[model samples]
Structures are given as C-alpha cells and as structure tokens.
Target: MDTRCNDITTRNKNEALCNACLIPIKENMRFYKCTYECNFVLHEWCTRLTTELKDYKIERDQLRHFSHRHPLTLVYLQQPNHNADDEDEEEKEKEKEEDFVEEDHHGGQCEMCNKEIWSFHLCYYYCKSCNYSLHKFCAELPMTQQNHPSHPSHILTLSNLVQSRNNFYFRSTDGTWKCSLCNLMWKNIYNYHCSICNFNMDIICATMSEQKINHPSHPHRLERMSGPIVSGCLACGNKHEGEFFQCTNCPTFRINLDCALLPTKLLIQNHTNGTYTHSHPLTLAYSYPHSEIISKYYPFCRVCDGKFYSHLWIYKCDKCRYYVHVDCATSKREPFMSIFLHESLGKTFKNYKEDEHPNLLHCPFPDEDDNLLKHHMSNQMEFISKQHDGEMLNHPSHQHPLIFFNEQTSVDKKMVSLHDPMKRIQLLCDGCVKPITTVPFYMCCQYVDEQCCFVLHEWCAKLPSQVQDYAGHPEHPLSLLPKIPGKFFGVFKCSICELQSNGFVYGCITCEFYVDINCAFIPKEITHDAHPDHLLLRVKPSTNLSKRYCKACQYSVRYSELVFHCPSCDFYIHVQCALLLPKLIKHKCDKHPLSLRYEPVENHISQYFCEICEDEFDPWEWFYHCTTCAQSMHAACGPLILQCEQATYAYDQQSVYRFLNVKFGGTLEIKGHSHRLAFVQGLERDGKCSECDTKLQYEMIFKCLECEFALDYKCASSFVS
Candidate 1:
C-alpha cells in the first residue's frame, strides 16, 4: 500500500486510519497506501518495529507482555484459543468437543487485560504454546494511541508541533499540547498529541471515557468537559484545571481533576480499638454536619492529615464511623482518573467486586495503572463478623486465622505458666515489645503448635493489609510485613520511632523502607490542648535540627519518633510525650477537679509548683497550674487524669485570686505580738519554715519590731510576702 508517490514526508497532509496499527494518521506523519483500488495505509514506524519483539528470558521472538507469563506472537488477524497446529485427530476432536462445551473458550475474553472481548473480529496477539491471548490494543496501547474516547467521532491526528494551525484555538499553552476535553496544556510526555481537531488527552486519560465518571466523593455521577470554564472545585477550592467532574444533578457542583480522581477510602492500619481485628473499617467523611457546629467538634481529616474546611468531600467508613481526606491516600495532584465507561455495572471499569478482588490490593508486583493500589487502605465499612465468633477471629493481616482468649491462667503449648509463682514472667509482645499484660491478644496457634512461637497484639493483629499515603513512594504502594530481618535474624528495630518493636510494620520491599505501627498509623492531624492555635501536624523530626523539648512534659524530645509540630508557632512535641497528661481530672488529695494548662501562668503565691508532689513546676510546660487555688500539681505524680464533674463556681481571674492579691502592709501589727514586725522575702539564717518544717531558704518571713523572734509565712499572725 502506497499513500504517497514519493518519500516527501512533509508534503503529505491527508490523515486516515493506519491499517497496520489501527490508529489515526497525523499530518506530516509518513504512511504508505496501495493505489490498486485497495485503500490500505501503514505507518512508517510500524514497518521498522517487529510484530513480535525478542524475549529477554523466554523463547525467541516472544512478546514480553506485562500481564502475561507466556510469550505471545502478534497476529494481524484474530486467532482462536485452540491452535490450528494441534495435529492429533483424537486430540483435535477432544479440543473441538471442549471448545463447543466451554462457551468462554472461544477467545471471547482478553486474558492479558482481564476485559471482555466485545468481538472476535479485532486484531490480537496469540500464544502458540499455550492458551494465552491479548487484544492488539492492549499490546501496543502502552506506548502510543490516537482517536481516544473523548471526541470519539473525530480523528485526533498527532500534533507533534506545539503551535496550532489556527489562531482561533482557545486557551493554548506555549510549550505543551492542549487538550480539548480538559481545556489545559500538558507536557508531551504526559499527553497524546492531536493537531486536527485540536483535541488531546493525558497518557493515562487517553484510554478512559470522555463522558461520565463515578468519583468516591460525590454520590452523583460526573460528566466530562470539552471547554474551559470559570469554576472552583468542591473538594479543593482551587480553579487550576479546565477538565473536571460536573454533577449530573446539580450545576453548582464541580470538581477539578485532582479532586475528582482523589482516593476516598483506605484500610486503617492504626485503629482506636486494640483488638485482634478492628470492629469496622475507617472512612473519610465530614465529622460534623453542614453548620457552624463543626468548630465545636474541631473536625480534622485523618486521611489527608489536614484540618477540615467547611463543605468539603472526605472518605467515610460507615462501620468504623471515621473520616479521612481523599488527598492523603495518593500524592498524585495531577492523576489521570479513568472515567466509569460502563456505569451500568455499578463500579467503574477498573473496579470489580470486593470479595473477588481481595488479592488485587495485596499483590506485590502491580501494574502502573492498577486501581487496586490507588486507595488500598481506604476502609469502606465492610467489617462483617459475628461477635460470638470473636474468640475465633478472622483478621486480614495474619495469614492464619487468629484466636483470642480472655484472661487465661494457663498458657498454650507450655510457653509460660501464670499459675506457678516461680515461672511467672512478663510476656513481651511480638509487635510492640511492650508487656502483654492485658487480655485478648491473638496468638498464632498453628505456629505455636509448630514450636515457632508466633503472637501479635490485639490491635497489631487487626492492622490493615496495606496502607495508602500520597506523600510516600510514587512508583510502588507500601505493603504490610509481619516483621523485618534484623542482625539477629528475627529481632528487629523500627526504622521509624527507633523503638525495638517486634510488631507489624508497613514496608516497601522495593525501596527497602519500613515504619512501625505507632509511627505509621498515627492520625495526620491532632487537635489537643498541647497546641490549640493550629492543629498539630504529624511529621518526621528533622535530623539537622537539635532535639526539641516536649511542651507538655518539659522533657527533651528525640527525632527518632514522629512528632507533632506547629510550623507557625514553632511548637514541637512527641506523640508519646503528649499522651502523659489529659485534659481534666480529680485526685484523692483534692476534692476539686483540676485541668491541665500547657502554659501555666506564674502568680503572686508560688512559682507554679506542684502542691501534691511538692516539686517546682515549669510555668511554660504542661501542668495542673491552678490559678483558682493558687496551687499546682504534677499529672505524672497523680498518674490518673480521669474525667470528673466541674465545680459549681466558674474560674474568674479577679474573683478566684481576690484575697491573695489583697493589699498587704510592709509591717504587720499582729494582735498576738506586742509590736509591728517587718516583712521579709525569706530568712537569711537557718530557721524553721512552717510549710515544710525544715531549715528555711527563700521562705517568706516576718519579725517582731521589739524582739529578734521571727515567724515564717504560714506561722505569722498577719503574714506578708
């Protein structure tokens, strides 16, 4: 076939379907067509590239497909599943009998793509040695394509040159090709060039539907755009991209590409429940209703690890009753989300039934466009289990099913005995390496029976099989591993947190990266009294900076553990350091309840010292620095910060310290003493202090004007300090 008489590639302007690759022809692109009444054209590049590439490992001339194991040979014509070369008469008869009986064996399915073959007439690739088969589109579509679903009726001829033919093209980019559907320009590497219709698509979006899509954020379907519009995205209040998702039901609803394709659900590896399995899955959703009450709840998104803005989409799991931000699952701000072409099937084209596709997310080696890794850990409230069968737990993280026990006196497999005093021992957890004193841990009975000694914390056993974090490695999704190999083979320390945890960890085998449960599973944003001005952001402490002190405990904070820090205020604290003190609590020493104050204000009486523990307190650090009682206490000394009822009287700075701030004379005329005495800051010489009844130093003192006899602050008839 000859489309041109001469080899003048620049002279040819005609564009048509390339008969060899079945793709559109672009202007200035070389092609050949037959003049003998038959209109056939083949791209010049198609002639140079072999139909079957050389296999690096397997047989010669083997097509190395990403999805299949066997080498395939490209065929211009469609081939049947059964090879015509099978020559045995009996075997041929058997094959024909099987082919007729097996309705699915007629090459009605593209094995490599796992997609239905609409028709057998299309060109395909065939494996002569096996039953493997692939569509021609699947084999070649990985690199280049034209005439995509968007502007399906039009031929999107390749536009290698950035300059458009006509100046009438709206919203054109200087150095990039512009997409008609999205109304945005993209780098040549991420997009397919089209000059004829001035239509283009990003590399990933090229194969997707140009019409409608189902995003996890909105309940309604989204329609594709063909032109630029001035609208802000509902998910993120940004007006950057032109192509976006518009609601079918509402005109006001518009989502940018970044928001529309953002992952909404993920499995929560860190859960509130410390049991063998999390009772329910966690989802990203609004913690509060659409009202001003959201501020009262202090809503924060767990997925994106960000503070919540009013009226934004979040991933929510009904069962877990939790919400996370969609952006947290993937770091792809400019992702090519494939539209749901076959909406009649409910889920998008890439998504399948959850039960049938469990392994899709857990696969070690996944395709670049694989949807399973898109939101692997996004929980969808699919937690279904009988409470009665909790003793026989079925956890996703463990290979073998777990069995939990409630406070057993005797141990399984004679590992330890709780009955014998001589054999009493503290069983350290395999996951956290903390004492496993609490009941209800899921132990691997199969392994224990095999004498391997395998066990996990209840919460550790219930961790999600995978985690999805956008700011992490972009190439491969992180997978959960039971343990890592240490210098001692089985024993290992956490790469993050730096604790010697023999527990569950999220790891990327490809990158040789690992993070422990406490470090990996912590929420993205923490709303607490520790730093109330702005929500504390979870981040790895920088090694370049010196170790920071925890604001709560006044202890030096290490960079080994992930800490919460406010960039604006320069406030930093470790997760473990903040958990020490609670909001409010009551102690046996005092009848009234005490509240924790991060920045304890020093007053006239004492320098914010703990009355209970009798220790000096750090006014800037967290403590029960009482402004009302003019007394402070240590949260650690009391050790219990249980919630209690508030007093009838509310704390008023003027009213609470009215008596303490009263005017005092420099010399007090005591009724018991004969004369007026001078008030002093403290005693210069060794003397008794009534508060502690010991040798006084810096203790307030008052002396009689007539005698050398002195009285400490507490013993003085009319005290002054």
Candidate 2:
C-alpha cells in the first residue's frame, strides 16, 4: 500500500501524512514508497494508521467484513480464485458440506436485519455482538473494475478511492441526473462517471447487484441479462439496447428498472371502508392485467388508494377482498383501527345511554368498570348488526311510506295498508324500468298485453311530449301527436330523429313536420367524412343544388329536399343521415369505444390516420375516433354504412375542387381552352410543365406544349383533388 501526498510537504513529521487521517512519519533514506503521480514518500508506520483488525470469517473462499457486510475475496488480479487443476476427493467433500449448510439455512436470519430471511441471495453473514448480519459481497468492494454490464468499456471507481466533489458530473442544477438509473433528471448528487461517453451513474445504482432483484411488479424473480438484449421496453414500448429484468420462465416477460420499482398496491385515504369494505379499515388496489380475482372483485389497494382492475395482492379478508401491499403491511407501525372505528360510529351513538341501552346490557363489567372503552365498542357492534337488517327510513327520494318490495307487484287496485304504513314508495319508470321514488304517479291509459301497467313519475310519463324544429324542416315545430296522420304518407318519416316514425309521432300542427320523440334532441354539429373542415349541419335544401351526398356514411342524398349541409365545405347529406348521432360511430382499429368531437378551428392540421382506407387525413376534414382507445375513422366510412340500403359511388374528386372554389368564391383560367374558362382555386403544388404555362396541381395530368395545358389554381389547390 502506497502512502504518499502529491502536495509539497516535509520528509519527516506530521506534514507528510495520509490525507484521510494524519499521523507522524519517520524519514527513510534508501527505501521510498510514493504515489505514482508524485515524489512524496512515507514510512511503513504511517501507512497502517489504524490498528483496528475487526475479525471477519471466510466461507467458501469469500470473506465477510464488519464495516460493510458485503461478500468479498482476497485475490491478486493475475491469479484466479479457482485453479485450473480440478478439485481432489478431499476438497470435493468439504465443498459438499458447505453447500448443504447454505441450503438448509435458508430460513436463518437475514445478514443485514438479523431477522428471519424469507428471500435468498448470493452470500450471507451473521454478527454476534449486535446480532446484525449481511452478505459478504455487501461488505468489501473492489476499488475499480472494467467491462461491467452497465458500461461495457469504462472502469468504475469506488467511493473511497475517489475525492468527493460538491457537484455531480451528470446532475442538473437541482442535483438530478438524466441517466438511465434515475430515469428522470435531478439537481445534485454523487455519481460515477464515464469520461469517454459523458455517462454518469449514481452511487447507489453503480453498486446494484448484477443478479436477480426483487420487484413489486412481478411475482417471479427478475434476473439480470443472461441472453441477447430485448427488442423493446415492456413499460413504455420503446426500442432499447440496455440492461433489463427478464423472467427465467417466460421468454416474453421483460421490464425496465424504472417500471419495476413502481409501487404495487395503493391505500386510498378517502375510500377506505367507505363503500368497498366495512370490516377492514383500509382499501387497497393494484394495476391492470394481473389476477382474475382482482378484476372480478375490483379490489382497491389501501396504500395507493387506486382502483385495481388487475394485479397480485394480499388482502385483509378473503370474503371482503380487502387487498393491501405486502411491503406496506410490514412497514405499518401505527394502529389505524381505533381511529377508523371511532369516526364510523361516533355520530350514530352520540345520545345512547350506557346504563339503560339493552344493546349495552351485555357489558363485561359494572357501569363504572375501568374497561369502559371496550364495553362501548361491544355496544357499537350490536348497533351495526341491527342497522344491517335491510331496513331504511324516510329516504329523500320517496314521498309516501315505502317498504322493500319482496316481488314485482301489479299496478291494479293494490291499496296501501294503514297497519304496515309504507315509509316510502318506489315507482318504476315507463321508459327505463329503473325505480323512481315519489308521491304523485302518472298512469299510462294504454296497456301492452293484459297488464294494465299505470304507475310512473310525472316526468317519466311526459318525457315524450317536448319537441322543437326537427330534421331540416324549419316550418314544422314537431310535438308528440296522439295518433299518426294519414296525409301524404307512403311510409312515415320522422322530422326530428331521421328514423321511420314507427312509435308515437311528434307532429307539427301547421305543416307536415313529424318525428319520433328521441329524434327531437339530435345535436346540430356532427362529425362527417365528406367535409373535413367542419361538422355537417342539418338544413333545408338550397334551390341552386348540385348533386350532393352524405358526408357521413357515404350514402346518396335520397331525401333531396332536406339534408345536413356544411356551409364551409359546400357538403350536403340527407335528413336521415343528419339524424345519426356522433356517438354511434365505431372504428375497428381501437379496442375502446370512440366519440365525435366538433372542432371549430379549421387551421388545426389533421394528424390522425383513417381506419377504413389506412390513409392520412387532411386537417380540414371532419372525423371521428374512439376517445378512450384512440381508434380513428372517416365520418363517411362510419360503422353505419352497412345499414344503408342504396349503392354509393366512390367520393368524386372533382366535386371536392368545386366545393373549395365555391367556398372561396373565386375564378381562375385553365390552359388548352379557346377562351379562358372560369375555374375555382383548389389544391396547389409546385413545378410548372415545360410545355405549358399552367402550374401542376393533381398528381396525374395531360400535358401539351403547343396548347399550354395549365391547371386552374382552385382545381390544383383542393386537398381531395
């Protein structure tokens, strides 16, 4: 061991000493031991400054030290731990006994905590004094090493060998690092550095064992890389060429270090024992796609408080399914049962007399007993039992006295009995069979079969009455009519909801405006495939009508008199097409359902791909996508296309150009015509034909040098064109 200081100092005395701990050294004339970089020298006495030879035991050629309880071995770099010559009979017998002891002591104290060890590792040790124990590898570490898995070529220096610095090489101003170990950047910290690549590893991360590590995400132990690098990270789905945890049993199972450390279970403070569980004080949950029981019961972890659809968990009760994190359970130091119980029962038992209450009659001691708290708790349990008898009083929604109905009852002549005196009455809605509690009941006069069902709330019975200007016919104010009209009807068409007027029809008194009650509330702005710029609007057909088609569902304008039109794009659709609500459109590309969004800004670039044609979308086009799953589809190619009976042609490219020109209300000249033809400015592209002065527009076009066949600006500028 070299004991030398590079700085100028005297040859003898305390001046020439180790920087860590200073001690006087004697001068040596002939013999000298100096640092490689300097000429300073020290005597042998100065080298070994401390006389602390803490006894350490060696097992299987590995030594366990007290200072740091990691496993270590004394071996020269030139000499390997095991010799090339195979072990003889005597050595083999000794090795077998060592292996047996290690295997049988699996349940022994953890070398670090001196507690019973349930998990295993590469090495172990026990401290006799403090009963504190740890692995030998965790004690003595090498000063430097090369070709480590994290860094293939750079040598990692130990903390004791390097001088400390206030600022870390990798951390930002706040001591955070962008290194893979932390995943996120920090402001300040000590870190290992690779000068060549400028890569820095934190001290804790640098010492991480290159072996199986216990993580909360997976049940099986995750091992260090013993095979080829994985193609992608399991958590973020990003391609990577780095160290990752892989399950030995499953080839496909892989996860990054950051994702593996995420907390498994959560205990919600607000939801604990509120709705999910009554017996347990805490509520627990986990992540999705783990265990079938978690998804089936929808158990929430009490630690994180997040609802868990799927993940492995240890719960309080097998019946209530109150799950919690195993680590959280172990670290829980304080009792929460008392606080939770007091909060739940404090208000209900505020006035109950301890002496007179029969539920409190079974108290284990006299009224003045010292264990009054325990007796009070016993009485609270009795109150809870009585409250669980499936009885409720004066629920806010109910008007008359109501009782829990044993069976569905008929509405014919059943009078309320005064002796039972119903505390509440729950009437079922006529439209949706869900029960509605109230006093005054509206009975429907008409019967469906022999059952004269006549009990419902006033709002439920009159729900079919309200209506307004429906469909594209503004002249007709649609209202629910008692009977269907016989005038000018082949098949009754609804003015509100575009569906056939099969049920109760809402008809206009002045004109032939009629629609179903459901159709009256059809929203105006809706997503459509035909016009990309804006949602289609329901309107009466214009007198100057060119051929038009439904932007959504891609159907022909069968009912030409009335249609859904987009003024911005000059797009039109039949009234029936406009009646289709935006929510109904479903795209196959996404697993979750999609919804329609109405965007007013036309400048926003369309960044989605179409599910139907598998093509990029023009920003100006109106579209629909599953909000949750992100599956997108052209409004024209919505799922309702199958229901359309008529045959439809592919969307006309020329019509799009015409619509654009009409919107701009501009004119331009085209080439190869005797007179300059009036054309609207459409989609435009660069490069004029050499033969013609006309600028190129569409991808494919006819060119003539003599005639100069240039496209009009409107025709070339249109996105669809």
Candidate 3:
C-alpha cells in the first residue's frame, strides 16, 4: 500500500526512523507506518526482504494482550553482519549460536510461562512501559481453550492472575490461587481460568510445559519432578504432596511448585489499618544467608514477632537484613504482592513547606541577635566583634552576668567573682544538657560561693526566646525557659520525647506543654533511610488514648507526644527513635561495626538474645548486629552516647547532675556504712534509691561494695565534693 504524506511535521520525522534499520526515513524512501499508534515504522522493501531472514518478525508487530497493561511490541536480536572480509563461516555460526539466547539481566521474564526471557533478540511480545515480556509461542497460545483435559466442562479464558485477583482480599496462606493440576499457589503470571466453575490452571500446567527452568532465586537449573520429596519445601517450610522442583546441582535444595513460581520480589502493605509498610521490596531467599555472621539458623519474623523455624523460606531485604516468614510476609492482615502501580503510590518527596521559624515575626532572643555576637571556628580573639566583649548582663537563664571563654585557663585577675576559678572541672551546657567538651562557651562570671550558677554553649546561649505555632505543639506559642518554673529542682520530663532533662525548654505555661531545646528544633518533615520510600511528616499527638507504636523498635511513644509518620503509607516511627537509631555502631563486643538490622536473619545454632545485656529482646524490634562476629544486641544497649574519655563528669552537691557522668566504677564510703559503695549499671541493679525512694536501676547508681545498699545518681551527687 502506497501512502504519501504531502507535509511532514518534526514529530513525524522523529517517528519516521525505520524500525528495521533505525535510520530516519527521507521523502524519497518508501516506508510503512506501524498499524498501532506508536513510534515504529519499517522500510517497505526491508519488510519484504526480511521474510526469509533468520530473525524474521511476525507480520503483526504489536499486540494488546490481556495479561499486561501496555501494548507489546515486536523486537529482534541483531545478528552479526557477514561480509567478504569476515573470517570463516563456522566461526560466524558459533558466534551466532552463542549470542542466540543470552540472558538479559534487566529484561525480566515472560509473564505467560514464568520463564526468563533468554534473549531480547528472541521473537517476543514486549512491553517497554511495564518491563513485561512474553515468549512468542507462549503469547500465541489460544486465548480461550475448550475441551482441555483439566475441567473440560466449560471454556477456559486466559487471564492475568494479578489482574483477575485485584478485587480479592489477600490471605497469607491463600492470597494466590492453587493450581488445579499441581495444587500449587500461583500468582503474578497468567492462568487459564473458568470463572463460573471457579477453576484455575497455571500456564505451565495448561500448556503441559515442564522443562529445565532457570529460577531467579537459585543459581542452578531446577528439574521438575512428579512426586513430593522427603525434605520440606524451602519456601513455605511445610511438607506437602505435590509436584515440586529440585535443584540439579544441590540435591537437598528442593522447593514445592508454588515456591518455584513465586515472584522474585514483593511489596507488602498492612491491610489491617495499621501502619507497618516495609520500605524495600522483599526478595525471595532460596537458602539461608552465607554472607552474614550467623549465631543461629532461625530468625525472628518481623511481622508476627515470632521465631522462625530453620526450614521455612523467607522474603528479606538484603540492605536492611529484614526477614519475615513467607506466610507472615503475605498474611491477610498485611497482604503483599509481587507488583505495584508506582503512580498510584504516594510521593516519596517532602510535601510540607519548609519551617518558617527562621522568618519568625518576633526574634527568639532580643539580646542575642546574630549581628550582636561574633562566632569563630577556633579561639581567634582578633575575630571577635568589637560589640561582643565576651560578656552578657542579666541573661534570662541565669541571675549572674555570663562571660564567654574559648579555652581552659587559670584564675584571671579580670575582676573574677568566682570561687576557685583556678580549679579544673567539666562544664555542662545548661541549654542542651550535654557536656561542653569544646569551647567558645559561656559561664557564670558572677558566681555564688555556694555553687556555680549557669553555663551555656555559644550556640545554646543564643536560643530563640520564643516560638509561635511550632509543629511539636501548635496549639499555643512557647516561651523559652532556662528551667522549669516554680519548681525547686528544675528537672522536668520533655512533653514531646518524654525524656527527662534539666536543659533549656520551650514551654507554654497555659498548656503546660514543654519540650527540650533539641526537641524544639525538630523539623516538621524528615527524610530518613529507615523509610526511604516516603517523607516522614511530624504528626501531633492524638487526644485519644489508643497506643500507637513505632515500626522500627515496636515501642510506643506517649500518646501525648509527636511521631514521625509516613504520609503515603501510614508507617509510624517515634521521633526520638528515628533520630537516635544509628545505621551502624562500634562496640567492644565485636571488632566490626554492628549494622542496624530491622529484622533478625537466620541463625539455627542458638536462640535469639542480646550479647551486650545478656537478655532476650523482641526480635522484631531493631537491633545492631555484627555479621562478622555473630554478635547482636538491642539498639538501646549499643551505647548511643559519647565515650567517657571525651569528657569527665564532675557533679557538685549544689548543681543538678543533668548531663553529668559519674566515673563508671568507683568505691565511696558513707558516714553510716562500713563498706564503700561501688558504681554499677544494668537491669539487674534493682532496688529503691536510698534517699529518693526511686528505682536504682532506672539510672546510673552506686551499690554497696560488700553489702546490698544502693544510691541513685541524685543521692550519689549529694555526697560529691
């Protein structure tokens, strides 16, 4: 058919490239356009000349299949061009054979037969949009087969299992269909179904195709067998009588037919209105991990928080080392599937506007304006601004005038009102309550002889005096407070994170809401690797008393506190847990840095327990693990704080031991006790505080060196000089 165009637009010229040779079609060249509305064309003569070629495409170049969402286009693997100057024909033939059926790593596989597409050059119906392909023969199978051996009573219509089951509620044990012939769970691929009869036959069974299949989960080819093997199935860990596949190389490595056809990756979602979507695609693991250090063969399931038997197959994330039992991963309450529609999924990027705190209508601290203070990386006196004489009068946090110091020094004759200014002592910043190891810090210049008054980090000294409509507590504006007002002892529990701190706080007196300086600056939205698929929006506490738990550690934040919530997937993590859980940590128990594992992996040798605390913890909760040393421990036991060598903690009787650290192990004698008390720590250090009447193990405390007497940090500091 001769079709001539009088005028060609730029768009048509782009599509004018002949699909056969990839060369743009000129005005004089005869070409045939694709029948379908796609970017494909063929040189008229090239189509006729290729009929007898080795890699001849079917007359119909594009197919709209019921199995896939997009139209499948025809593609060919280019053959090596032969010429007069080329080498021997035998060598050329060998090269052609070798290249004939090479594997395409990213090409994926045929949805019809559940087999890898050996070569893109092989004639197949391919969908460029969805990365789906179908073998030419498999695609050409009769769409409706009547008089089939399995269920001959009615006509069977070809259907995509995933598409057909879109409305079906998924169950962990029954989310997919069981093949009528082989009795294996089937999903993701095509199936021949008689809807009225409620009968389904897998494509492999319908076509009676049983060949050596290359399963993505294993390295060796799997041979199809007719009977069940003695060993349990690797995927589900259950022994069932049915058709199965056994690895050709590893005789012991056998899996049921359903497991053999399981999709390579799955996306699981909580269907129970609970927020627990696993961030990464879970891959089917054929064998227990050989890569990580294994203390035991059974791992705890992330979903059910139950122990895994050694034989059960699992779907896991290699990056996070997250593991779950096959059933638990695809359970009805939290059903999972092999594929997802990406566009319908929520955005991963932050949707909330940037925090407007920087552009506040009123400055937090009127006296500590950016223009008023001078900052330097090091102790450079020359760099100090003329306006800043290293001193501030009547600061809100303290009664005494404060002077900034960049380094440790002996008593200075610059009119010091301090008691023993020459004495060396570790200083803690009253703002953050962290030890002030590095200077350019402010200390009370007008000190009372009884106690040192107040100290601050240079940055802490300039905290905003007030913030309005903050995300953490949006109901009311918060005024900065150096310490809790109307309380003799300034220690107060933070309203947001629920951690006790004597640090500077942003509080609203009317609401009785308070957050430490660190919590005050919590961003409205955060992007963490823990849930990389979506931004974690800061959610205000709910008035309802129902407990909401974190996905990572499975711990509950106080109902009155804020949480980092995934807007797209309903996943929730505690704000403090999200910020404090390190991806990797160094511990003395193992030489290697222990990586944070969201879920425990297989270790058949022993039961799960923390190496550091020597206690059992919820395996579903996040933990730090050293695969090299086979050491694992709770995230809390990994020593998130700085080492003791960085700064010595010296608490005086007059000041609160807010961020103070007592020398870990030491003996002290009291007036009434004959034996000295030694510092000890652990969950086992249980007893009421001698003076405070609180639990001793709740905080670092001292126990009697030879008796049962114990004193908490509050009481212990009272005895310090």
Clash count, candidate 1: 27
Ten-residue stretch with the least lDDT total in model 3: 363-372
lDDT of 3 by residue, 1-721 (tens): 2222223223234335553344567876666664433333566654553333334334568765434445678766433455445678888756644543212323467877676554322456788777788876676665567788877787675555322233231223434667777787766556777655557787777765434666666678877764344547777776555567788789887877655645556665632123346655667666555433244333456565455554456777744646776755654221223133121222244444446333211111111112111221123443433436545645777777787765554336342232211232334466775445455667777543425547666767766578888886678889999877763236577776666666678899998888877777766666666555455778876664255567665555556568787655556777666654546655555667777776554442244577755666555566778777777776666652333221122212111122222224435666766778875552344568777788654366677866677888667757653
lDDT of 2 by residue, 230-349 (tens): 456554343445457788877677865434433322322322333222332332233445555433334334343334333333434323334454333333312532343211200122
Candidate 1 lDDT tens digits, 1-721: 1122224232254657554444667887886654433233456765444223322334443566534445677544322556567577778757755544211123444653344333222446678777677665555543334345565554442223343355222224554555555555554333444434445565335544434665545677777664555566777654455656678698788877655534223443433122112223434453235563232233334333245566765555453224444443333333333231111101112223545534322211121111111222235323422233656766554567666755664456355321111132324445543334455566665744654344555555555667677233435666777666442212244454343333556777777777655455555545454433345666665564464555555455554446676664456666544432345544554655567665424223224456643545444445564456666665444322121222211122111111111112256665555777665434335356533465443334566656656666566633421
Better of 1 and 2 by TM-score: 2
lDDT of each: 0.46, 0.39, 0.56
lDDT of model number 3: 0.56
User: Order of candidates by lDDT, top first?
Assistant: 3, 1, 2
Which order, best to worst by TM-score?
3, 2, 1
Clash totals for all candidate models: 27, 67, 10
Q: Output the number of the TM-score-best candidate.
A: 3
What lDDT, from 0 to 1, does candidate 2 have?
Answer: 0.39
Look at candidate 3 and tell me the lDDT of residue 551: 64
Model 3 spans > 4 angstroms off: 1-389, 392-394, 407-427, 445-454, 472-475, 486-488, 541-548, 556-560, 580-612, 616-633, 638-688, 691-695, 700-721
